[model samples]
Target: MARTVEDAAGAPHILIVGGGYVGMYTALRLQKKLKRELRRGEVKVTVVDPNSYMTYQPFLPEAAAGNISPRHVVVPLRRVLPKCTVRKARVTELNHDEGWAIVQPLAGPPERIHYDYLVMAAGAVPRLLPIPGLAENGISLKTVGEAIHLRNHVLEQLEIAESTDDAELRRKALTFVFVGGGFAGVEAIAELEDMTRDATKYMRKVTPQDLRFMLVEATDRILPEVGPEMGRWTAEQFRGRGIDVKMKTLLVSAVDGRIELSDGSSFQAGTLVWNAGVKPSPVVRRGDLPVDGKGRVKGTEYLTIEGLVRAFTAGDNAAIPDLTQDGEFCPPNAQHAVRQAKLLGDNIVRSLRGKALKPYVHGNLGTVAGLGLHKGVANPLGIKLKGWPAWFFHRSYHGAMVPTLNRKIRVVADWTLALFLKRETVSLATVEQPRADFELAALDGAGHRNAERPVSENAA
Candidate 1:
């Protein structure tokens, strides 16, 4: 039924499952390779995602730190893939054998889509643990939305702390706790601390030293990707700044703003940020795709799943071998994901033409992290760099890598302005609820003010 329906169009249909790093790049590659076919509608490409844009996640930390505007970190799929159909929908399930997928749009009923090719680049979600109060209070930095919200929430906490005279309330408000000492947690905590500490210097009754920051790591060391020496150096730098680094510690619970740790320590911290880890998107399992124990799709170096050559997978979703290191899979990082998407795209095009497939192989260029402002740590190309050079390199590398020329320019522009101007400490938290003022004004102190309006008036 699916094949017959798609065959009626007299063209091959390519369906991309996610509008993330892999999905966007794959569609762009297809659009470039089959430009003539796309013009004639001989080959149709469709990308379905909840958001119409692909977010450059590396810039997320800076975006949250207000070093870059939130608007510049995301690329609109429609703008990038003009030749492809960009559908703002969530793929509920995909059945490759049936050659069809069930997708739910923003407001419409679920619809079945038939396609000749499927790209399982659905990406990963924040790995959540079954801990109490986690669902209610913990925050993860997986999306640009989450990053921006965290920025606002952190600044708002400062506001709460300053407005109150209660020492307990102020301590609770001023204290910030970050669980997971990986790159995400370390960078986030570092950037946020810098921002808050700098911000505190100007606020009334608040000193930079008043803010209490703590990092809780289950492992003895953080940022194992950069090697132990560098990780320890990074941790030492944090400790020098008076930030507590609790190694080999775990967050047992965060119930009712009371945080309990595995080391028998307890604290009343109002903010709890979780960046422990990530697992493959649950959608992979929902679709019944072949995945490893960790829920990552099992795929070969050619970026194709086992027994399904036509269907390609990459990024965090697929568990492809790391040729650089024996007996290990590719680390789920931006560098590997971006490189994999480029090769995955070419492999898909080759598969269509019955051409030879090339295996994906890319070595780590090295890791660079911005501690804050002019402070950073890096191990780029095996050269260990610290202080200004690493910090500048960190900014420059990420600035160059952020997708699209428009965004790259804007991000640099934001940085350039920062040198001459102060970092914007104003928290536009109201962005979360833009209609609150309107809703209040349009009320009668009981119910909605326009309840008696006709359908036509309400619509207007």
Candidate 2:
């Protein structure tokens, strides 16, 4: 039976799953390309995801360090993709044979929605190890909420270090451990470590040297994106700033806030940050679709899923063949995700209109990274840069890539103002548990008063 366009009012429905870079950008491009078709009720694009906004992940480290406002990094879906139907629901299962999917809505029951076409862009999730207490105690920097939590947690550690008289407790609170040395871990630790150092000047009791910043990587070097020479330079730079870079070190366990490394070293810390790696979301496995060894949807050069004509996949969850490389699949990164999404959108339209589909083939443009203010590393267009020049390139490249004019302008304004104004050192630690301190103090005071009332009653 052909699926009827019920309440879609006779429009051909295009159901897109996931709202990450691929899903959002594909929907945006579709609306622009198929505007005339859409007006004639020929098509209706519906994007379903758990989030209403798409987060720009590159700036998360800066946001965590208070370099930029958290709100500015996320682009609201409804405001940008006004022509499409945005649904805040997660696709629980995909029945490719039936040309429909089971969507679990945020507020209500799961509903089976039929579609003329389907695009899977469900991105990856953090790849966590079996390290003890990691899931419960360690914090991740994947989302805006996690970044904000890290910012608050770092500042709260400073406060605890300042007020506490117990030497062991203070040392543990002041020490910060970052588990991964990749881009996310390196950028986060560098920015936050810089922020904490600057904040210590205002904290009378706290000193910069007193705080311990450690980076533990299972690999031999950090920042593999920039290659070997610059990676070595980066490690040296961190060492100069009093950061302990422990390479070729494996994390044995992190049970009960105690970090035990394979090198026979043990340390107690209140904060543990994990940024090891990522894996495709489990939603891919739930679908009866062809997947790669890594559980990513296997796709051909045209971005169409293998053995499925009406279905397509892209972004981190799709194992699209890398035509640029001889025998390799595309790497999971925002750079490739955005480009693949554009190509996927065009291919979809071509397929629908009976035109020849184009293959996705784009060579990587190299990599860039920011290590703090006026400090960075980059290798763009075969040009190697370091220190201030690299930092400039990092900002310039990302500033141009940020979606929408509103977001681009806001981010540029932030960079411009950061030059003249002193860095903001205030940490909203209380934001996490707003009522904890107050409630604890009130309870303690009430107990003291109750104890005095018994003596006063006896005397009376």
Candidate 3:
């Protein structure tokens, strides 16, 4: 139902969509700055997202490898933004021209929401290709659910390898293949390989040497963000660990776990991780909002949607001008998104006060990625670091940036615990459908005083 709120409520509404990094940060800043407006009920902040939490994505690889607890990597929206109305829903339609958005609740039919202003920061999803069998076999590392599932899947493969009698079956069970060479792909494969190699120590039959790890990339190098030299070095690091770093190769097909590569090679692998790239969120094309050729909401350096009144966007979904470089847009990364959200929040507040909006300018803080526990690479402020120092810097920097003091403390605690204890490797794959045994029991009448009884003839 398209219902309108009466003005008797008094305060103007500001609806924020996509409660990720941008949405959460923007609303937090607004709540503090517009203290008067919020306290006096002069303005209302409502945020709509599919989840009730904002996930800190950088920790996903660690979470998948059992280095960090999955629970610690996500921030609860309701707890973090008490002043903001956090609604769990998916935005199906947004027509800012009429100041209304149609959103479907998590479990219900679509409903319409009218807002005075809009913030589109829904973020991006993994860009997928039409490679055969990828739909059935490929796993992604985007969300916590996917991370947990990957952890279980990897562990289960180890168990399979340990129990299998056939040599080819064991080989297939131990083969792990990853597609893509970007930050996500490299870090994920590295961390996961590290964990699995360690897991082999506990298995009776499986050894580190038995596992085959391969990274398939279409490009000549990996981690282009760190430059070709560093990318080559990173590839060498993986190769040294017995990982097949397949450069200039693409996953042609994976029909029924038969991974066919563009390099005229094929393999039977149990795992396929896709981390090729990300396009902007599909939300951008929903309305008349201007967008670049890439489908990202066209945003000025000021972080406002071009010529859209009271409309602002930031994060991966927005193609905000890259004032730091010529003829380039800001690359969609956590470093940029976190910085832009602060500026976007301030600009939104400034707009409310009818003040001039300032253009966003960010100095590249450089990139840092952890390969495993005590190994990584970092380029912070032009100083290149590798090994343990780089790994420490990577964890320290991300810990400081994971949003909210509570999450920061929790993540730090998770790391602290990892130092004392071995990696957690409990695979709860059956938990996905936990009651199957009970359902089977019911079907077979396994425990039945009533099941043995005949139905009454008088029963309807």
Candidate 4:
């Protein structure tokens, strides 16, 4: 389905699939380092992804809580990687032997794209479980759409709690449940809980005590990245705020707004947020690439896939060798993903110019987590931090890491305004059903009633 190539004129056409952290950054660095080659028509670069922007995932929780503007957390691919051709499409299949891939663009028919070199950094998707009703009733906080949905949904729930007189119904509407104690689940729940508490101040009927927040983790502790001691301290911090932290518990069911836990507990809630974990995207399997047991592309220390010199992989989708950990692979995190991308880009350039390649190696730097405003925990260089200092470190680290200067400035501005202005509590729930009211009214004869009333008035 590829468009006929009138000419394959260039140094070599390099096609990068996926526009996540690794893909976008690799292309950006390539455009800078290989500018001369690009200008000479020696090489042409193209980056393809279903999304036009690369989301700085670390700031997602803040965006969900309205602490940062959602727009500021995403870096537009084309804007930053101007030297590369950005294709807004999803790669359906890769024929490495044929030197082409099947791409399904946003419009038109599927087409084949030819490439001399391929870089796979398609990233991962949310690891969904078979828990009942999760796919239909539960919401996720991974993407921009999901984050905005959660923000508006939380505020809408508070509004519902304020208007209801039935105690049981009010409790159900106010109660929020989060599954998974990892960074995503814990941070999102903590931030949204903080935002909801602040919003309750404007409600005459709703009280902070009336709202219930629950965190469910199947393991013995939370925040594995911070070690056991800090994890225990984090649990204590949440408990101090009246937030229930359930450890060693499993979510058995959540069908029809009813949640049943493995610990012989049950609750009904209008909203459930799931942030369990992620698995590598299926795109890696499309190519005849070496993969590890986890289905991630197996990459050497130099970021090249074994037996595939022209193909490279990195980020969450690549199982890179952990040189520091003996035989283990690098853990999937932004820390490793960013470093891998830089090394991958350098190796790509070296290969193109017939230069020696360098190995990608970096030791773990520790972890950080933000628990709402002025509350956080971190284990930077094995020195555990808690309270306000940890929160400051978390914000500073992520603010510095967020892609462009424009986004960084906007995020900082949002934080500054938050100090003086109250958080916005309005929810646009009608967004979920823009035309539902009119459709329902038409079916109920309200539209006919209005039409007949106008005719009768005119006749009179």
| Worst 10 contiguous positions by lDDT, candidate 1 | 1-10
For model 3, state the Cα shift of residue 5 in Å. Answer: 5.4
lDDT of 2 at 39: 75
TM per candidate? 0.94, 0.93, 0.95, 0.94
160-226 in candidate 1: lDDT tens per residue?
9889999999999999999988878888998899899888877997888889999999999988888
Segments in model 1 whose C-alpha atoms lie over 4 Å from true places? 1-8, 442-460
Where is model 2 more than 4 Å wrong at Cα?
Answer: 1-10, 434-460
In angstroms, give how far residue 428 of model 4 lies from its true place. Answer: 1.7
True-structure lDDT of candidate 1 = 0.87
Model 3, stretches more than 4 Å misplaced? 1-10, 445-460
Please provide, for model 3 over 91-125, each residue's C-alpha lDDT reduced to its tens digit, 9 standing for 90 to 100. Answer: 87889999888888877667788888789999999
**lDDT string, candidate 2, 290-394, tens digits:** 888888998989999999987889988999889988889998889999999998888878878889989999888989999998899999988899999999999
Model 1 residue 358 CA deviation (Å) reads 0.8
The 10-residue segment with the lowest total lDDT in model 3:
451-460
Candidate 2, lDDT over the whole model? 0.88
Which pairs clash in model 3? none
Q: In model 3, what lDDT does residue 48 have? A: 93
